[model samples]
Target: MNSTLSNNPAVVIGIDLAKTHCDVVGYDKNQKIVLKLPRISKEKLLERLTNMPRATVLMEACGGSHSFIRKVKALGHDGRLVNPGDVKRIRCGHQKNNMLDAAYIAWAWYIPGISFVAPKTQAQQDLQSLQRIYQGYMKTRIEFGNRIHALLLEYGLSSPQTSRFIAEQLPEFIETHTKDLTPLAEEALLMLRDSWLEASEWEKKAGQKYDELVRANEDSKRLMTIPGIGPKCAGALLTHCGEASRFRDSRQFAASLGLVPRQNSTGDRDTLGHITKRGPKHPRSMLVQGASALMIMADRLEGALGEWVRKIKASGKKYGVKVCAIAAKLALFCDTKDPTRTVNKKPTSAVTKVSGIFG
Candidate 1:
């Protein structure tokens, strides 16, 4: 790791990061390649950047990019995480390598109208990790449950629809049907049932941890004030949105959540389509699910939100579209609040205001 490059401080530095090594390229103010370092270890890369004069650092938004940006910022450099798609659009030539990608990332930073991804805080990353863990556990549990159900069906046995039904009634069902099933088939069913039970327990434990994480975060607590938003939904929103203030207004915020409609227009003619579905799917799905839950209980809602829901229902739009529209509205409502505002105490008034609508 040479310190000469740091002492000279290029105008912009781009990094293409991988698990074990990073490709780095630097450009001077005139867009000339002033520095090139390929396949540098993570520690070496950090060492070379340390104590460097402040300069802009750019990287494609990818796994570990957030953490890398944090390191660069600590060294007094401005950090920007550009979307990979944006970088790809600007990349030149068909032949691509880490060095070229890094150079492209730096050039992409200077492109007009390029969108940069906000670097997530450590806390946000932690919440996202918890959410991913919970999702993984739930997915595995469902797969196991499905396998058990299919196995039983193949043997002419019908299982109850309830989630816990298999765990509770499996032993009895197995015993009674042992004569009907071959020894190997019976053993496989029992094994699958046991695996399903284990997965269910793991899923429950993950859910508890996710709830605890959300409850401990102040942003998540305030998010829960929104109608139909529970700990999981709140956590997902907080993790994804980071700071509501980043968006200029509620509409932009909702669009970032992929709640806004896609547009296609040419020569004065206009066409609108479904949502672009551009962002993380989990939080977007969670918002839609929350909106659906709210619609299910709309009769109990009394105020503006409830009335709005009724109006949408009366409009004759498909149920899915209505849910998406409401989810967008909910996102806008969330964006109206300041993320930095201290809401250490329970959000009683906020909850009451929302509850009043339903009442």
Candidate 2:
């Protein structure tokens, strides 16, 4: 450790993190750079931070950022993950390097109204990882299934649209009509089918793991109380948002998830555009899917939520917009309604207000 760093403890520190190296810049209360450690190993970085006086640590939200924040918090220091965009907005000069980036992060820390990401817990990260794996497997399965369908169609053999149906029936069809397909084509179809089956199994296992995690979590249980949300959807939202209490209100919470529309307004003029699509993709996707399912079963839905859905549909909004509205409404519902206390109670004023917006 440098003498200056050891003697004059920094009030704020910024770290530019990479896979193997980190650049650290520290500022005193006067905003003067007092400590600059360029190119330190992760272990060395932790060791130095462990010894330093507690200070606010700023870093970009990126790979391993949450884990690093956890470690920083454990060391009795304040750790905040700033959005990269926020840092970019406040960045001063064109010249950029690891050390300069760290310095800029330090500067951004003092800027008011800069949004920061909450560090996720280990369990939340685990659930997110599982969800991502499941999505990957699902994509692979779909792609392989599509390829198999196209290949079969080339041979004038049509299979059912269902993945399971295709996976099961295609092999038998190929074996029976082995003469119909060229040897190369027959072998290729069999190989693709096998890959699809494997991917499907992996997808199923990942989904089961996700469900088990959701079922074991208390927050997820409460989230599942919403009409459209199930175990998977609830798990996604809980893991993505971490804590709903961080949001000032349900509307802000919904907007954070990008379920709300973008707005541009001037005196006497206002314009609303499409859904921002700005947050974690998985959570937004899950919410939209859940809301769409509820819309499909709108006739069966009964209550203020059902009535709101009908009103939106009758208003002749595009189908996608209606679904986004429902998703935003659902987020508001989840944020305001406590399952433990309000599970049996009627819809509250929050729900009414949300419905009024769309009504």
Candidate 3:
């Protein structure tokens, strides 16, 4: 594999990565094909790249792509990642295949203004993994809880006294309902309760892991200094955004989180609507939740942040709109990579002074 393409080295390479094998397409400086290989084993591809001269490698971001990018970077080559959507827009053929995908990935190198994803560190990836696991468990638990509630409703049972009845007094609730319950209904309720408990246990384990990891991470601690940014939010943000250095400024960071407004403009006029709501979804949603909590306690806030909240409220936007705007500001403040960067002349004093509420 190494000797096969050592003669005509490429300036750009594209990889369409799959489970076991990957398709690699290389192009010279003039967009001319230098070497093309399909279904090359991952081991052979790396072995071949290890022997070749350093060049830029491009790929669509997906499963296994980040790990490969990490290896490519370590091999002293520029490893760039493109959005699969972006590659599809530039790909020359109407027909889609591995070769075409790989070729356009290389061609995208020459297409100016295409955004490339930065590869994350092992630590960031690990934090992200823990957060995702916790989210999954919590989501499952909620589903099970909802199923229990629906089943109870089917039996003419009144709504539980509390929203969290499943986690609190679910066993007692089931016991009391035994008189009204049929055999199958009781069995289904018992199964769902057990599933909910299992999910809860796993969620607790994952949460503890997050707490341990975030406490040890100085950047996570620093990020927690901002209002509405907690351990979960910090962990999720780091997982998705890597370091604040990846973003040039706070606006870029907010935009990356899809906090910025969606743009739809024509030649003579400009239009803006709701946020694009793109990028890492979990952290963005978490930030919004944080912002909502902060707004509820706005009276307790002081200084610039308090005033900023008041101004947004006075703007007469809908409640949801105000929440999203606040979330965007919160994201900008979270971008402490450049602490000097501020939003709308409001300072961090407004953010940090009152953030202890979340603690």
Candidate 4:
């Protein structure tokens, strides 16, 4: 490592980080690539960067980049994620290798209108870890449920497939048909029944664990008070929102989640497309599911908003399109905490307020 570049001269470093070795490139304010180094171990990399007085560091947002970003930031330097997509488009007259890629990121860091990723905090990372475990268990559980349904179909015993039905009815069906089933089939059925039970238990544990995390955070509790946001959604949002104050407005937060529509305009012609789906997926999925649940519950009661949603559905749009619209509005409303952001000015439905009822 060179100490000359480590001093207080303004420099931009683009790091191509890997598990063991990192490729680094340093550039001056004038965009001249002054130093290029081969792979260095993590300790050596940190020592070099820490020795440097201060510099803007750029790295792609990837698995290792998350912790590395935090580590670099702690050393009193700016660490930014250069979207791999944008970096992909900028290679010219140079070999496409780690060194060149790093150099490009350094150059891209200072570009106009480029947004930098907000580093997540330690607490946020822990929440994310819990969410990942929960998400994995839930996904596997869904798979297990599907397997049970498929197995039953082989026995000419098809039932309406659902998580609840699998949890409650599948075991009873297996027990009742024990005498008729072959020894091997009976064993398999019992195993699947136990698997479903395990999945259910894991799901419950995940929820309880997440609830504890959510309850501990006052901001998450405040978020839960909003419609269509539950413990899981609130916890995920609070965890993922690395600095809610970093966002100038709730609209920016919504846009970051890709909840906002895409726009296209050419010479007085304007076309708006679906959501960009550009940010953390867990929040978006949770928000959409919450909106769908609210919509379903609201439909059971005759209400102004439900009636309005019915009208929209009756207008020939698919039910999913309507659900997505509601979800987007729900996200916006929750993010802003401004009642005025609601798309419909009508009174809230009975079931619409059930989220608040949880309190």
Candidate whose lDDT is highest:
2
The alpha-carbon root-mean-square deviation between model 3 and the true structure, to one decimal in Å, is 3.8
C-alpha lDDT of residue 291 in model 4: 75
Indicate the residue-level lDDT of 195 in model 2: 94
Candidate 4 C-alpha lDDT tens digits along 1-359: 43334333548888988888888888876766666667877788889788776888889877778889989999999888877777876665567887778778888876788877777777888898888888888887888878877777787777777777776776677777776666787678668878878987998898789789878887776676556678898887877677666676667777877788789889999998887888889888888898788766766534345566566656777676777777776655543344333334444523233222112
| lDDT-better candidate, 3 vs 4 | 3
Instruction: TM-score winner between 1 and 2, please give it.
Output: 1
- Local distance difference test values of all predictions, in order: 0.79, 0.81, 0.80, 0.74
| Candidate 3 residue runs with Cα over 4 Å from true position | 1-7, 161-164, 334-338, 341-359
lDDT of 3 by residue, 158-277 (tens): 657453677678778878878888989988987998898899999999999888998787667767767677888877777887645666766888899899999899998989899999
Q: What would you estimate as the lDDT of candidate 4?
A: 0.74
Model 2: how far is 156 from its true place, Å?
A: 5.6
TM-score of 1: 0.90
For candidate 2, write residues 253-344 as lDDT tens digits.
78888988889999999999998887788788889999899889988777667788878877887899888988887887753543322222
Sorted by lDDT, highest first, which candidate order results? 2, 3, 1, 4
Off by over 4 Å in 1: 1-8, 337-359
